[model samples]
Target: MHGPVSAAWLLVALCAATGAYCLLRMRSGVEEQRLSAGGEALMGFGMAVMAVPTAVFTPPRWAWPLYAAVFGAAALRTLWAVRAAPRHLHHLVGASAMVYMALAMAVAPPGPHHAHGGIGVPLLTGVLLAYFAGYVLLAGARLVPAAGSASGGGSTAAAGIRAGAAGWGDRPELARACRLSMGIGMVTMLLTM
Candidate 1:
């Protein structure tokens, strides 16, 4: 647990929890479906991180392909979200991160001419990472709860969350919880890897 393998596994747990939270919160709105798509993206990446270290974790030979699929699904969902979104930089960041993940898996050549990781220094990859990171921050700042409910009945909507009395729509606290959980998980997975 002191190195990359440990780190990767930790991220796996964090991401899995995030996915679980999304599942629980998915019952909130007409737009809840969009969040589900993003959750799937995170789950795909989490699975990829899990598969990266072991050559026989799954259909052994399909390792890279699995990663490729994760990258693709995540990228596509992000793109769709951005297209459907209302001109928000947060949406753009999420989309960029997905594209970056895909590029990191396939676009880079197998040499110094390509990125070694960390999304490259001065390229779209860097922009993607930054964007995704921003989305994570935005998402964390607002957690959509079930429609018509709020921890504090007097709460108001901010950051896409529409809180109500039935229950909290997306509230910043819930968003923060999701962020912290996934953030911890990402760190853990990266460490294991």
Candidate 2:
């Protein structure tokens, strides 16, 4: 978050809004949805906080380590949850990335812009950027309607559409889109770092 203040605030808004939506998604009757949404909400809010511009309010010296600790615990939780839901592995990666970012920020020099210096390993950031870039592409693809679908006059497809349109919490496509947005945001943050 060493960029312009406006960009930082924009990221904050995007992440906070996504976090709010994920909170609503937690109300879904599906247990898996609830679990995933909870984890996503955590990520969204955490990213928002981390994205805050340094000029606005720099966190205490201890805060970075706290962030690392919290995200490290989140990574562990996601690791355990992955046993029940394999998809939680993505959450694990997200949490681990957060931990990495936190540690990087912690070691960064204090100044007008917390220059990354050599604290953030270029290779690791490159790996994370590549991973999230691929994830964004894949999640975005999942949100797009498939070509040649028999939805022109198909009653089943129509009913399925109607069902998916019922509530935001139950819509798989929106959820995928949300994840895509987060992946993009992660890529942006990593680039700034």
**Top lDDT hit:** 2
Q: Estimate each model's TM-score.
A: 0.52, 0.90
**Model 2 over residues 44-94: C-alpha lDDT tens digits?**
999999999888888987999999999899899999999887978888999
Candidate 2, residue 39: Cα displacement in angstroms equals: 0.6
Tens digit of lDDT per residue, candidate 1, span 7-48? 446555566666666565566554654474355446534544
Model 1 compared with the native: what TM-score? Answer: 0.52
lDDT of each: 0.48, 0.85
Off by over 4 Å in 2: 118-121, 154-166
Which sections of candidate 1 miss by over 4 Å? 1-3, 29-61, 87-99, 102-125, 132-164, 168-172, 179-193
Best candidate according to TM-score:
2
